[model samples]
Structures are given as C-alpha cells and as structure tokens.
Target: MKIDARSTARTLAEIGKWRGVLLYGDDLGLIRERAAQCVRQIADSLDDPFRVALLDQEQHGRVEEEVGALSLIGGRRVVWVRDAQDALLPRVTSALAIDSDTVLVIEAPGLASRAKLRSALEAHPKIASIGCYPEEGRTLIASLSDLFRDASVAVDREALFWLSSVLGADRAAVRSEVEKLVLYAGEGGKLSLDDVQDCIGDSANATLDDATTAAMAGDRAVADIALERALADGLSPIALARACLSLMTRLQRVLDWMDEGKSRQEAIKLLKPPVFFKKMDSFTKALERWDGAGLRRACEAVQGFELACKQTGCPDLALSRRLIAQLCLGPRSFLR
Candidate 1:
C-alpha cells in the first residue's frame, strides 16, 4: 500500500503489523522523521522487543546478508535500509523474500511510478510505501502557523506573509527562524514586525537598510552604528565590501529609474523578486544621499578591500573590523 505524506500520522497509528515498509522521499528530513515514527509503531505492536538495524548505501550488502541469516529473537526483527539506490534494490528485494519474522524498512531518494521496484512493492501484500514531498499552498502556511502555535507565540497575518516571502525556500530554515522568533518573544507574547526585524531579520540586509536610511537623511551617526554592527557580526572584509557595493548599486539604479519619470512601484516591479514594500523608504532615502558618482566610488573601494583580503595573512575578523572603520570614516579614510 502507498500512503500520502499528509496522512502519514494517522496511517502510522493504524498500520497493521506488516512484514516490511519502504519510505522514500526527496526531503531527507521528512524521510528520517517518518522512518523513526514507523520504528516506534512496530516496537509498540510486538510483544517481545525487536532488533533494529540501519543500513546505508555502503552497508546494504552486509546488512542484507545479516537479514537473511537472522531469526526473530522472541518477536519480529526490523531492519532499516537508508539511502537505497538502484544498485542495492535487488539485494533488498531478495532479503525481503526470506520467510522470517523480520521486517525490512527501506528508504530511497525517489522512485518512478513504472519502476521495477515500485511494481514489486505494489505486488507484495506485506509491503507498504510512503511518499514525502515539499509542502505547498495551505499546507505550507498551516505548518508555519503550527510552529508558532507550538512555541506559544502568536503570529500576525502580516508577519506570516513577511516570513513566508523571505524564508519560504527552505522549510528547515523557516522552522529555525520561527523557533528563534518564539524564543526571542518569550512566554505568552505576540510576535510583532519590530520583533521579527530585531531578532531573525537578515543582519546584512538590515545593516544596509539602516545605513541607507541614515545616509539619505544625512545622519552620519546612524550610518556609523550600522557599519559597526555589521563589523561586529564577523562579516569578512570582502563580503562586507561586496554588500556595500551592491547596496549602492541598487540605490543608483532606483534613482536613475525614478529620475526617468518611473513610479516607485514601477521601479520595484522592474527589480528581481521585487523589493519588499517595507524597504521602499530606505531605498528612497539612499537615493537622496548618494549621487551616481559617489555610488561608483563606493563600488571601487569594495574592489580594493577584496584585494586586501586576498593579499593579507591577517585574521578575517580583524580585517573586517578595519574595513568597516575605514568605511565609516569616509572614502579618503580607506587610503590610510
């Protein structure tokens, strides 16, 4: 029998004591998680405890030999084969055929619908297969919400939208960020946009925003603070330099487009991934502070820093600090 990922929880709970199971998915995390659950289920069903073996690609042949040789201690034996590929499938199939009280659990990357392995597993009355995939649409949003709820944190709609937009590419990263947000918020607290900005926000991008905001308003103090924070975060000199260059480049482009009678929205649309609405104010301010010439000079300085990083044996943290100090002082400060 083949089961869908969403139905896995209930299916595991109700699964009969089958002789074998094959759990496969593209996502390794989900595959391992489900496999653990299945092992627990088998343990619960058996009167006497069973032995569990984890076989990887390299260990599959040896494990298959062991499976063929071993008998149930007092109950069923469970063997878990992970990272199963085409080369190991035949051995696994042969091992599964042995008429013993042993159960084989197999995990693989993925399988085609018409593949021989799929056909064999489907034909076997004693085998069950489960599929896991990346979550989508409502499932994705719901999972995010559940993470917040589990952490006892209340996530507003706007906050969820912001998070989903920024961190949705990797589910694991999203979960980590949500956990961080929850921890930052503490008990019985609501997560606000400011909290997100303060805790889990992209520091490099945040630094750029702060610097751009201050520079546009001609506030040297704020720009200096942002530069200092970026330095303290251990960003390499070359990385910081590149980021500064990119920020200035973007500001220049936005300014040029706006000057050509383009609306802010139109400029944003032309930008890849479209700038987040919250970042528009910072971009507007940055454009006011630096002209095309100044932005070009900043890019040039970034190239110089890249050379320094390559040539010097100095520790990366120290080099980064020195670079930020120089940038904070002014373009001329880089000369010293």
Candidate 2:
C-alpha cells in the first residue's frame, strides 16, 4: 500500500492490517516518530525484552531470523530495523511473504525514489510504504492548532503562521515548541504572534540559535550571554561550533541567491529548511558581513576548530569559544 505521509495517522490507525511497513524520508524525526507510533499500535510495549527486537545496519541479516523465532512468552514479535538499505529487500520480501502476526518495521533514510528495495516493497500487496518528508506549512499549522485547542489555549491565525514558518523541518521540535507555548499561555488563555515568538525564541534550543546569529552579527554582548547560557545548560563547545557552520552554510546560499539578482525576500523564499521567523532579520544582517570568500573562510575555521577538538590534550571548550569569537569579526579577519 502506498500511503501518503500526511495520512500516516489514519494509516497507523489500521497498522495491524498491513504485513510490513517501510518508513523512509528526509525528515528523520518524523520517520522515527511515525515508526514508533506504528509499533505502539501493534505491540503492548516497546520495553518488553522478549517481545521486541531492535536492529540496525550492522545487524541487517538477523531481522528475518528474529521474526521467525518462537517467542519465550509466546507473544507476537516486533522487529525494528534502523538505517535499513536496499540490500535488505529480499529479506523484507521473504519475511512479508509469510502470513504471521509478527510486525516488521524498517527505517530507511535517503532511499532514492527509484531504489529497487522501495519499489519491491511497494509492489508487494501486503507491504505499506510511506515517505516522511517535512510536513507542509498548512499541515503543520493545523496540527499546532489541534494541540492548542486540546490545551485550551486560544491561538490566533497570525500566531499559527509564525509557528508554521519557524518549525517546518522537524515535527519533534515543533511539537515541543507547541507544548511549551500551551504551558506558557496557561488554560483558556489567548495566544498572539508575540507570545509565540517570545516562547519559541526564548527556549533552550533558541539559545543556541541566538548564539549562532549573534556570533555572525559580531554582537559581542549578546554572543557572550547566549553562549554562556547554552554552555551552562551542558551544550558542548564542538556542537555549538557545528551549529555555527550550518548557519553559515545557509547564509552562503542566501548570498548566492542575492548575487544571482534575487531580492533578499525572493532569496529567502527559496531557502530550504527555512530561516526561522525570529532569527530572519538577525541572519540577514549577519550575511552583510560576508561574501563568497568570507563564507568559505568561516567554514574553514569551523572545520579546523572541529579537528582541534579531536586532538590529544586540546583545550577544546576554550579553543572553540576563541574560534567562534574570531569568526564574529568577519571572514577577512580569519585566524592565521
């Protein structure tokens, strides 16, 4: 069965009717989330050692073996394969070919549309295939509204739009943000755009985002506060450096768009995994300090800093802070 990602909840409602399920897509959080949801539908609990089996790429060949075995407690077995690839198609096909109560779920990330494994499973009458791409804006907003309604939080359309734009990439992040918003608003409280922005942008995750933008914008005071808070909360220095690198890459793409004669708004409209609404203005300002060479320099600095963190006896935390501080100065000021 070819099930649409948007229809996963409805499909999962009937999960027991399917012999096999293949969950693959770009949105890893969604893929894993839906996979777990399906498992919970078919099984009593994931924690039961005798009833559930967790497999990965390294344990590829054993899925069929585990499913075929007789359970100690005689319960229907649940076999989950993570990071599955096309090579496992034969096993999946053979396993699903049997009429059994055992459930098989595979998490295959980045499987091509034309991949033989996916096609093979889709062709099977008993198998269900779903692509868990990032949720569309409307779908995301609707889900957010549903959550808000359940929590008795009154949400305005503008606030929903703000959330939709900010959290299109990761469902887990979006869900977490919404929960915080509901809590922040309390029961039966009206939510506005400012409330959404205040709650989402002031989160722990947002602290890292603020640090990334402030570092790029060369705002010494803001950078210090953001970095200090993030570190105090146990965020590692290398991890923070990597976030800066990812942000820089996105800024570079925006720069490329600008160079091609697109207006800033037009360029931003084309970015994938979008710049969050709260950080959009800061990100735009930060890009003004760099061109192609400068962006390249920033990437190089982050890469070098990553290597230093791996070196023997390196003062990684302190070194990372220094490297990011230098990057705050702009690309032409690259540390020699």
Candidate 3:
C-alpha cells in the first residue's frame, strides 16, 4: 500500500511488526531515520537477534544469498537495500516474493506516477512507498510547532516564520536550529527572533549574504571581510564555489526577469522561497552589478577553482581560503 507523506512515520512504526516492509523516499535522512527505527523495533521483538545487512549498488548480488539464508537462531532477520537503483528491481522483486520471517527494506529515490518500481510497490500488499517531498509553508509551521512542543519551548508565530524563511526546506537543519534556540533560551523559556539570531543564525549564511551585498554595493573591503569570515568558518572550497555560482545564477535570472519588464516584486514573488521584502533592494543592486555575462564568467571561475581544490587535495579550510581570495581578486568583467 502507498502512504502519503503525512502518515508515513506513524504508518512505518506500526507496519514494522509485520514480516516485511519496503520503505522508499526521496529524502535520504528521513528515510534512513524511519527505516532504522523500524528495524530496531523489529529486532527487539524477536527471540534471537536478527542480522542487519545494508546493501548498496555494489552489493546487489548479495541480496539473493542473504534473502535465501535461513535464520541462524530461528528468529526474525532484516536486509536493508539502500540507495536502490533501477538495475536492482528484478532482484528486489524476486526477494520480496519469498515467504519468510525476514523483513526486506528497500530504500530508493523518489518516483513519478508512472515509475515501474512505484507501480510494483503499490501493487504489493506488503510494500509501502512513502514520498518525502520538502514540507510546504503550512507543513513547515506545523512541524516547527511540534518540534518546539517536544523540546518544552514555545515559539511565537513570528519567530517560527523567521526560522523557516532562513532555513528554507531543510527539515534536519530546522530541527537543529530549533534545538540551538531551545538551548539558548534555557529551561522554561520562550523563543524569540533575537534568540534565534543569536544562537541558530549561521555565520556562513550571514557572511555570504554580507559579501554578496557588499559586492553589489561596490564595497570591496566589506565583501573581502565577509568572504574571509566565511572561509575561516571551515566552509569547503566546493561549497563556496557552489554558493558563488548560486548567487550568480540568481542574479542572472533576476536580470532576465527585469529585462522582460517584470517588477522586482513580481519577480521575487515567482522565485522559490519568495525573496524576503527586505532583501529585495540588495538583490536588485546585485543584479545590476552582475549581468548575465558577468554571472557566467563567475560560474566558470568558481568551477575552475572547485576543480583545483579537488585535484590538489588541500584541506577544506585552506581550499576555501584560497578560492575566496581568488574570487576577491578575480575580474569583475562578468558583472558588466
């Protein structure tokens, strides 16, 4: 049977008692967390400890042998096939057909409506396919409330929005941020925007924002400082490269929309995560300073730096520092 995102966790916990279960989702973190919980519960209930095998693409052949083995101590067994790809569908299907006390949990990527594996799982009564799409606005708010309630802290709606906007769609990051806020607030305390800014606010994000903002405003010194801080924070060279490329991409898109006569408000409205109203001015200035050609060149430079970091095997901190320095000194002709 298929389970919607809302009921997935509860359903998985309950279904684990059965002989077999198939858990698949797009989010690797959520999938592994839920699957591990289920497996632990099943192991606890068995008379003898079960063998847990984590199968991957390289270990596809081992599935058949593992599935065919009789429980050594005559208790429940579990085989976890993680990161399942299309190549293993036949083997997985065959293994699932075996009538045994062992539970096989196959975790795969997200599936479209017409996907064969999804169709097979949907058809199988013992199998369940769960979708773990990023939470929407209301869902995120609800999740935040639950997280705060569990931590014995209260978050005002405004603070929740601030957290959500800053963290975007990363559930794990949001949970961590909430924990940081709770710790900062201490016991029996309420969470506020300032509390969040003080504790959970990432220095890298702030520095990146500042650096981009300074670059937009033509303040090289301020931009340099911001980039330096970001590098000092142990940000990877590849990560910095990606961030710079991402900013350039956003700037280019904003420029394209502006060229088509779209107002900044309208363009922001159409963008994912919906750029905050306060950031609109900064975004506009960045877009003005870095047009399409400039953005493309920045992307190319970052890519080259990323390749160098990988090839040189430099420490992440050293690589990031060098890359940031290069970016600071690199030609701004791309912004032309």
Candidate 4:
C-alpha cells in the first residue's frame, strides 16, 4: 500500500507488519532518515550483526537470502538494501513470497513514479511505498516554526521566514542547521534575523540573494557585482538562473494574491517562505514595476533562460548576466 506523508511516522511504527517497504523520492536525506527509522523499528541497533543485514547496490542479490535467514538472536530481522533499482525486483518478490518474519527495506532515493518496482510495491497488499519528497510552502514554514518552538528558541517571524525560504527544501540540512541555531541560541534564547543569519547563512546563498534582490529592484551595478561574486564563489550559472526564476515566481504569486482583492502588504505577508524583511523595500519596488502580465512574461523568459543554460556549449555565464540585466531593465525592454 502507498503511505501518505502525514501518516509515515504512524505507519513506520508498525512497519514490521509489512513484508517489505520501498522508500523513494527526490529527498535522499528524508529517504535515508525514514529508512533508518524502519530499521530501528525492527532491531536493537543499526549495526547489529545478528539481526540486521545491510546491503548496497552491489549486494542486493543477497536480499532474498538475508530476508529468509533466521535471526540468531531470536528476534525479527531487517534486511536493508540501499540505492535499490529495478534489477532487484525479482529478488524482492521472492523474498516477499517466503512468508518470513523479516522485513525488507529498500531505499531507492530517485525512483520514478511509474517505475515497475515502485508500482509493484505500491500495489502489493503486504508492502508500503513511501515517497519522501521535499516539503515546501506553508508546510515547510510550519514545520520550521514547530522545530524552533520545540527547541525552546524564540525566533522572530522574519527570521523564521528567511530560514525557511533558504533551507527548508532539504530536510536533513535544515534540521542540522536548526540544531546549530538552537545551540547558538541556548535554551529559551531569542533569535533575531541577524542572529539567524550569523548562525546559519553562508556567503554563497547570501550573494545569490543579493543578486536577485538588486536585479529585481533595478540596481544593475549591485546585481552585477553580487552575481560576479556568486559565480566566482563557484555557484553554477544554472543555480543563478533558478534563483532568479524563484524570486520572480514569488513576486508573481504576490501579484496574483493582490488580484484576488488582498492588499499588497497582505499579499506579500501571505507568501509562503515569506520575503526577508530586509528586502521588503526592494521587493515592493519590483512589485510596483511589474504587473500580472509582465510578471507572467518574465517568468516564461527566465524559464527559457534556465533551459538555455543547460544546453551543450551554451555561454551560460553570459546568458545568466544578460538575463539579470534584462530583468533589471524591466520586461518591456526584454520583450522588445
């Protein structure tokens, strides 16, 4: 059966009842984390030699043998296969038919939605197929807010917004950063935007943010300098293009909300992964300069920019700079 994200913890607690589980998604960190949780559910320790059998891409052929083997310690066993692929489907099917007490946990972090292995697992009555996609939008914001609340850390709303916008897509990385922030803050400590920035922000992301903000606000010199620094710091042209598209997407969303009768301030505030407070003035300026139709065109162009960056022998850096310049000059100039 397929497992919903919300019910994953509840389902994981009873994972032993399933013959096997297939964990797959874009979030490798989440897949690894959930796979560990499944192993812990069945064993005393992760490295327990007697109760847990660890297999990798090359050792997946041992899955059937491991799943059917009796635990020497007289408890249920767990056979974990990492980076699993469709080639192991037959072995997994054989293991499933063994009627053994052991549970097979397959970790395929990048499995396709319609892959035979994923489809088989999802359709099986005795197996669970759980996707570990990255959380975004309000769900991510809420999750980060809960993390801070649970840590007894008082974070300013804008600080939370910045953190979520920047790091919330990677579950493991965000959690690690949040732990660092919590330690930096100490128990019951308060975190302002500056505090969080000092604790968790890196130069590369900060440079990218500066570039996007400056470009949107029509500050070409600052945008060019920041973009140069970002590229010099080893950030890819594709990443820069994506960053611009993301900012434009957010701005377009705010415009959509305004069209729905919300005030501009209300619409901006309603943005998930809210705009950084420090960038509010520049963000507002960009908003004033672009309406729904212009933003729509800008978004389409930025997407094309990203595609161009991916082509072989394309002048990625030049295209990236040109895209930024065009954005700074406004859609009217580029559309011409």
Candidate 5:
C-alpha cells in the first residue's frame, strides 16, 4: 500500500509489521534516513553482521535469497538495498511472497512515479511505498519548529522563518545543521535569531553570499575579503563564479518586475527562494542602484565569468577577482 505523508512517521515506527518497504524520492537524504529507521527496527546495530544484509545494484540479484534467510543470531533480519533501480522489481516482488519475519528496506533515490518497481510496491498487499520529497515553505518552517521543540529549545517565530528561508535543498543537510543548533543551545536553552545565525549561518555559502552582496553594493573591500574567506573555506572557484551568476540572474528578474510597474519592495518580494531576511536591506540597496539595461549587462558579464571558470587550467581565482572588481565598479568596466 502507498503510505500517506500524514502517516509516514507512524508507519515508519511500526515498520516491523510490513513485509517490505520501498522508500523512493527526490530527497535521497530522507530516503536514506527512512531506510535506516527500518533497518534499526529489525536489527540492533546498523552493522549487525548476522542480521543486516546490505545490497546494491550489482548484488540486487541476491535480495530474495537474503530476505528468505534467517538470522544465525535467532532474531529478525533486515535486507537493505541501496540505490535500487527498476530492474530489481521482479526480485523485490518475488521476495515479498516469502512468509519470513525478515523485512526488506529498499532505498531508491529519484524514482519515477510510473516506474515498475514503484508501481509494484504501491500495489502490493504486504509492502509499503513512501515518497521522500524535500520540505519547503510552511512545511519546512513547521518541521524546523518541531525539531527544536522536541529538543526542549525555545525558538521564536522570526528565528524559525530565517532558518526555513536559508536551511537546505535536502533533508540531511537540514538535519545536520539542526543537530549543531541543538548542541549549541544546550539543555532548555532558548534560541534567538543571533544564536541561530552564530550556529547555522557560519557557512561557506554565507561568505559567498556576502561577497556577491558587497560586490553589487560597490563595497570593494568587503567583497574582496568575503571572496578570500570563502576560498579559504575550500569553496571552489567555479562555485564562487556560479554564485555571482545566480545573484545577477535574480537581480535581473527583480528588474523585470520593476519594469512591469511594480514597486521596488514588490519586485524584491516577487523573487523566488526569497532573499534571506537579514540580507534583505543590503540586497534592496544593491537593486536600487541598477536599472534594467545595466542589470542585464551585469548578468551577461557574470555569465562570461562562469564560462571562463569552467575552462581547463583557467586562472579561475584571478578571473573571479577581476569579475568582482568590475561588478563593484558596475557593468561598464567589463574587460574586452
């Protein structure tokens, strides 16, 4: 049967009752997490030699054999298949027919809706199918709030908003960062906006963001410092170039909104993946300094930097520096 999102938690906790489960989704992190929970439900340690049998695509042919075999330790066993593909459908379908207590947990990242394996699992009487997609917007905010609440940490609404806005494109990264916040807060600690920033906001992405924002605002010194700090943090030059390109692309969209007779605030609000609340003011200031034509020129210049950074043996750092210099001086300073 297909597990509803509302019942995923309850179902996961009672996973031992199911013969097999197909954990498939765009969020590989969530898929891995759910698979781990299932593994723990049936076996003591994730690495329990006798009870846990790990499998991959190459070894998937042995899934049915593994699922049918009893644990030498005299308890339930778990068969974990990682990075599963549709070709394993027949084996999984056949394995579900076994009357053993062992449970099968399959992790299939980026599984298609109509994929044979997915369809078979969802329709099977003894199997549960769960889709693990990334959380966003209010869902993301609520999850973050619950995570903090469960840890007995009191986080305010504004702090939650800031976190949801900047946390992740994947559940694993969000979980890792949340663990850091929990540790930083200690027992019964209250998390303020400053606390969250100090713990979760000190990331390489933040430094890159600082560089792009300062570069756009013509603060050459701050831009250079942030760029150097990001590089020191081990972010690749190609990553830095891409960050600049992404910001310029967003600014161009903001200009498009403004040209449509929208006010500056309205245009900024229209930006998808909305600007980080703390950086809103600086982003606004930078947007105000550019018109449509100039913003378009800046976007094209940043694109060129991105392309150059991708070339083999390119002096990516120097090219990135020159691009930032011109961006700080506005688009007319582009090198021929």
Candidate 6:
C-alpha cells in the first residue's frame, strides 16, 4: 500500500509486517532517511558492512541473480538498490516472491502517479510503497506536530513558527535539530521560543544567506566573514560553492520573470520549491542586486572550482575561497 507522509510514523511502527519496501520521492533527503530507518530496523550496526548490501546502477539490474544466490547465513538480509528505475521492476518482483528472510528496498526519484512499478508495489501483498514528498504549509505544521508529539515534547506556539521558518523541507535536519532540542530540555520540559532559537535555529541557512547576499551586493567584509563562518562549521568547499550557484540560479530566474513583466512578489511566487515566507523579502532584495551577467560569471567560477576540486593536486579549499572572494570583490557592478 502507498504510505502518506502523515502515516510515516505508523508505517515505521509496523514496518516489520511488510516484506519489501519501495521508497521513492522528490525529497532525496527524506528518501534517504526513510531508507536508513528501514535499514536500522534490520541492522545492528552500519559498521557491519554485511548487514546491508547496497546496489548501484550496474549491480541493481542483477537483482534476480543476487537474490537467487543462496546466502550461507540464515540471518535476515537487506538488499538496497539505489537510484532505482522502472527497469528493475521485473527482477524486483522476482526478488520479493522468494519467500526468504530478505527485504528489498528500491529508492528512486519521484514516480508518476500511474507508474507501473508504483502500482505494482501497491497491489502486491508483501510490498509497501512509500511516497517521500516535501511537507509544505499545513502538511509541514502537521508533520512538525507529529514529530514533537512522538518525541514527547511540548512546544510553545511562537517556538513552532520560529522553528518552521528556519527549517527547509529536509526531514532529517528537522528531526536532528528536534532531537537536540529534546536532549537539551531533558524530561518533562517545555520547548520555548528561546530554546528553539538557541538549539534549533538554522545557522547554516543564515551563513549561506549572508554570504550570498553580501557577495551579490559587493559587501566584501560581510561576505568574507560569512564564508569564514561557513568553513568553520565544517561546510565543504564544494558544498559551499554549490550553495552559491544555487542561490544565483534562483535569483536569475526571478530576474527573468521580472524582465518578462512580473512583479517582485509575483516572481517570488513563481519560484519552484517556493521560497519560505520569511525569506521572500530577502530573496526579493536579492533579485534587485542579482542580474544575468553576474550569474554567468559566478557559474563559470563555481564550475571551474568544482573541476579543480575533482582533479588531484588542486588546492580545493583555497580555490573555493578565491572564487567567493572574487565574486564579492570583482567589478560586477551588482544591480543594487
């Protein structure tokens, strides 16, 4: 049966009933977290590599062969096929029919509503199809409430708003930060707005936002400080670079929309993955200072830096720093 996001807890609670699970979603982060949950249900330790067998694109096609091979050990086994596609349905169906102690998990990108694989999984007696979509608006609020309820924690009303404002659609991040908050509060303690701010606030988002805004506005000192803070927080050079590129892409799209006669608010509304309400104004201001030319230069710089990181003997960190510095200090004449 197909599982909804709200039913995630209930499904997790009764996961043992299903023999095979197919987790596919738009949110790669949530898909991964659910896959891990399934693995943890069967695995004692991730350190034991044998506990789970991970199959990539090439190996995933051989599912029937892999499952048909006898396992010397009678213990339960989990075969996880990553980046799953429709091509594996036949083998996956065969694997599920073996009536063995093995569970097959297929993780893929978003599947169509009438997809054959998804429909087959839903109709199959022993398999559970899980949809891992990002929570938004009311769904997000409900999910948050469910999480806190499960965590046995009480959250203040204002605290909920603040926490939600800072959080994106990353379920694992939300759970991790909440777990931290729960640990900090101890038993029977209530979570306040201050607690949310101090424990669950999104420092990473702030750092990236600051760095991107500063860079776009040509504020060298602020950009330098924000980039430094990000590095200190263990953000990888490549990841930081991607963050910059991603922001540029968003701003450029908004600019494109505005050039086509859409207003700032309308352009913001047109954004895919819709900007958080709290960050709408920030993005609008960014749209003002961000233009196509700056975006092209930044993209080239980010691409070159990524290539350098991939090639051995390249100073990845230094190259990353230089890219950010140049974007902030160069003669781009930011539209602001």
lDDT of 4 by residue, 1-336 (tens): 998978887888889888878898767767887888899988967999999999989898898889889988699899999988778889898888897989888999767777889998899999888988666567777778878898999999878777766662446766777899999999999999889888775642545667877888888997888788777755566556656777888988898899899999999988766677778898999998887778778878888886776566999888888988988998696573
State, as a TM-score between 0 and 1, how close model 6 is to the true structure.
Answer: 0.57
Candidate with the larger TM-score of 2 and 5 = 5
Give the Cα-based TM-score of candidate 1 against the true structure. 0.51
Candidate numbers, best lDDT first, in rank order: 4, 5, 2, 6, 3, 1
Error of 6 at 10 (Å): 2.8
Cα error, candidate 3, residue 251 (Å): 14
For residue 243, model 3's alpha carbon misses the true position, in angstroms, by: 13
Q: In model 1, state the lDDT of residue 4.
A: 66
Residue lDDT tens for model 3, 9-111: 6777776555455555434445665677667776554224346766777998888777777766665677777777567778878887776667777777444
Q: Candidate 4: where are CA atoms >4 Å away?
A: 146-158, 186-194, 201-249, 260-263, 285-336
lDDT tens digits by residue: candidate 6, 1-336: 877666767776666677878887656667887787787786544334555777888897777765555445555667778888777788887887776766777788556566788888888877878888655445666777777877788898767765654554556656777788889877677898888778754573545556765676666787778778766755455455655676778778888888899987888787655665555555665666656787776677777776667555878768767876777664363333
lDDT of 2 by residue, 227-316 (tens): 777667555555556567767878888889999999988988787656667677778888778788888877887888866765568887
Backbone clashes in model 4: 0
Winning model by lDDT: 4
Q: How accurate is candidate 2 locally (lDDT)?
A: 0.75
Runs in model 2 deviating more than 4 A are 72-75, 149-153, 185-190, 203-336
Give all TM-scores, in the order shown: 0.51, 0.60, 0.58, 0.75, 0.67, 0.57
Q: For candidate 2, list the clashing residue pairs, or say none.
A: none
- Candidate with best TM-score: 4
lDDT for each residue of candidate 1 in 10-77, tens digit (9 for 90 to 100): 77665446767776644455566567667666654322334666667788776566566554555445
**In what order do the candidates fall by TM-score, top score first?**
4, 5, 2, 3, 6, 1
- Model 4, position 62, has a per-residue lDDT of 93
